[model samples]
Target: MDSLILNILTPVAIFLFIALFTLFAVYAERKIAGFVQDRLGPMETGKYGLLQTFADILKLLQKEFISPSASDKILFALAPILIFVAVFVGYSVIPWGPNLIPSNTHTGLFFIMAVVSIDAIGILMAGWGSNNKYSLLGSIRAIAQMISYELPVGLSLIAAVMITQTLNLNEIAFNQGLLSSKEIYFLGFWKVNEIGGIFGWNIFQAPHLMVSYAIFFIASLAECNRAPFDIPEAESELIGGFHTEYGGIRFAFLFLAEYAMMFLVAMLGVVIFLGAWNSPLPNIGPAKLADWTTGPVWGVFWTLIKSLFIVAVQIWIRWTLPRFRADQLMTLCWKILIPLAFVCMAISGLWRILIMI
Candidate 1:
């Protein structure tokens, strides 16, 4: 219960969760990929290839490390580690479960965006450091795509904060619960707490906010550099995107950053738009599962279940959707998602004013 102990243990727990999740995610991807492509996946490794990810890790670990002759040595080496650190740091700000957050700072949303924005720099550094034209191109694509999408993503996040009137992620989660008592905090100490929470978390707030949440998720996909927005690391063409030259443990770290970022964004989405650690029903919101009735274990259990459902959807999209072409990617972001996000912001403003008046 000491803040210092919490500061230390929480990260260990988060990364451990991420480590286990990554192995499972890899297997899940294989299984989902099989189902999508009409074939069996990971049937031999563990039951239905459940242990497939661990096996992949072993293989990846054993692979040789090869740096390109002309690569930017220092930056290339530092880039992935920097990325992993940035993303992992963001996880500390995520509100995991009720009465069960890491560092519930008022600057949570700010911290989330700040760290995520930095990841673009890492992607670019890795791409350029590889000293390969295709990798450079991939990283460039990643930079452009991620930067473009972040604007709308920021706008949508602004919408949530503006409506909720607090930046503390735990407070936001508390507000979203569909309960009568309305237990919401505005700061580390209660600040001007508003009412009604967010209109059905954040997704259902306004039709436009719903649109913004969609835009945010799509932008997040691009930002995370996942499928449909995966041009930066188009495997068939670029051989591995920014990480083409990386191998062995270095490559592992790159993806460790990738998976960590994936979890960070998913959890951020859950917290920002979906009400971080709050339960769906209001009655359960105030009473944490750690309360006398359910026990702390169930509280932790349900939290992971919710978070994983979001992550699973991300995986589902990856296997189902083909990667986007670079030109199409830019067009979707600059032309489509950005403008759409702006409209959502404007509408959200209008709706809020209308409700007040």
Candidate 2:
């Protein structure tokens, strides 16, 4: 009974968290853009525009739900929910802190990758249902981009999985903490199992993973349909892309899903490459900074900090970089990222073999 209640409450809590996070993230991105463009972003809504997102949410809630006259009503209405659910369900396996995962599946990483891919189907549905040429083109671009990038994302994750030898995300996170059961080494030389910090992280344990992390990060940016890789939603060209015909609450869900995807991918990167919730500061001599700062609560703190930092970088890149032409985007994924990802995988295999020898 308790377990059943917990399951019910967990999703409710996560839903609330996502809603609140979207509010903060939207406001934060506006401020960040303001800083980048040398303009005040939202000073009028509520001191520093703190309430701007809230105001926008209320407005969206009040707006009339509008659909194209000839649109497929059923699919058009269902697409946003599908898109949002695809991204939302991926959160189940995320390790928020020590034993804090909502669902600690043995195949956690694999599950997330699989479920998140469903967003492509949702996008395609939205486009096709809308019966808009622009929306269809956008969905086509999104599908191709997502499918192409999935290769590098999967290969890079496989590289990390080879090093960890486990598919459990909780275990992967634990392996980077001080209490890890397995011995950790710094650069495959000095043992750092006792030193638990940045040294115990996968990238440091196997330096080649730095390349893998880079590939993962770039592939994730594309997966999230973020800028440079955001041709699917190019405002100037597609006028809001696959969601062109959506309005009111349906559009809000799509918008929420995009930001949620940003956070989701960022958190995944943190868990896989950035030590999850583990402290970066190592225990040295009597300092014991890592020991002092690691616990269930601290775990949540560190995970959020690292993940948010990545999200900030994503936002920065959005404003700083130009959107990639569709051809350039596909070429980067197929020619560049996929090749590097393969090399990373090969190197991981060799590293594991050498360690055993």
Candidate 3:
């Protein structure tokens, strides 16, 4: 009974958190775009159009239910929901705080990558099921992009997991904090201090860790089908990617899933490299608090803050970089990211062997 209640409560808590953050992300993305382009984003809905996404959802729900005449009625209707659920489940294994994790699987890292990576299959289904030409082309492009990028992303993560020597997300946190607990004195000026566990994040751990961070972030952007990598759904070219024929609440589900996955990747990044939920400074945050406060809540708070920052950065990158051509996208992944990740993995293996020696 107690475990049941905890499980129920945990999901509700996380769902609410993801919902609110996503709403904020939607508004912020628009606002940032407006600011960057020297124009107003949403001035009428609520405070700075804070209610813009809510308004958009309501509007979408009320919009026409029209699908293409040639579209597969059942799949056109189901694809958005399917895609949404795929991204939503990816959130389960992510730890928000110290022990504030929802579902802590032994193979948490593998579980996350697997779930997120396979979402490309859903894209393929959605695009092909739609029976629309642009939808088909976009889905094909997305699958190719996902396939090419997943290699580098997975390999880059191998570097971190090798260093930490664990598959558990919380254990990954502990590993990072352990690294943060003792900073290697690099040239007497660079002090990568240990915070606790997740607080140290991952980027500060080693020279290669930073490279992994860059590699992971870029590959993540592609994996999520975000811009400049959003070529799969280029509005001008692909109409809407695999979702070109979706409408009303169905289309909204696609939008929701995209943002949710973005947040999930951010959270995963936080846990793997950003110290689960540890603060950045040396003993300045709750990680320095007594064991009680330093436990889950502080970790959760820091983790959210770190994740929010990453999401915002993702949004920023979207507005800054232009979309890539499908060919250009595939080339970047195979010709560049994959080889770099290969080298990173080799270096990670060598580093571990030396440490053991």
Measured by lDDT, the strongest candidate is 2
Minimal lDDT window, size 10, model 2: 348-357
TM-score of each: 0.87, 0.98, 0.90
Q: Best by TM-score, which number? A: 2
Tens digit per residue, CA lDDT, model 3, 254-287: 8788888898888888788766776554554655
Cα lDDT listed for each candidate: 0.74, 0.92, 0.77
Question: Which residue pairs clash in candidate 1?
Answer: 178-282, 179-282
Residue ranges of candidate 3 with Cα displaced over 4 Å:
178-200, 284-293
Error of 2 at 190 (Å): 2.1
Model 2 clashing residue pairs (backbone)? none
lDDT of 2 by residue, 182-203 (tens): 9877777879887898998888
* lDDT, candidate 2, at 115: 96
Q: Write the per-residue lDDT of candidate 1 for residues 21-88, one digit (tens) a residue.
A: 88787777778888889999878887777777788899988888677779989988888888888788
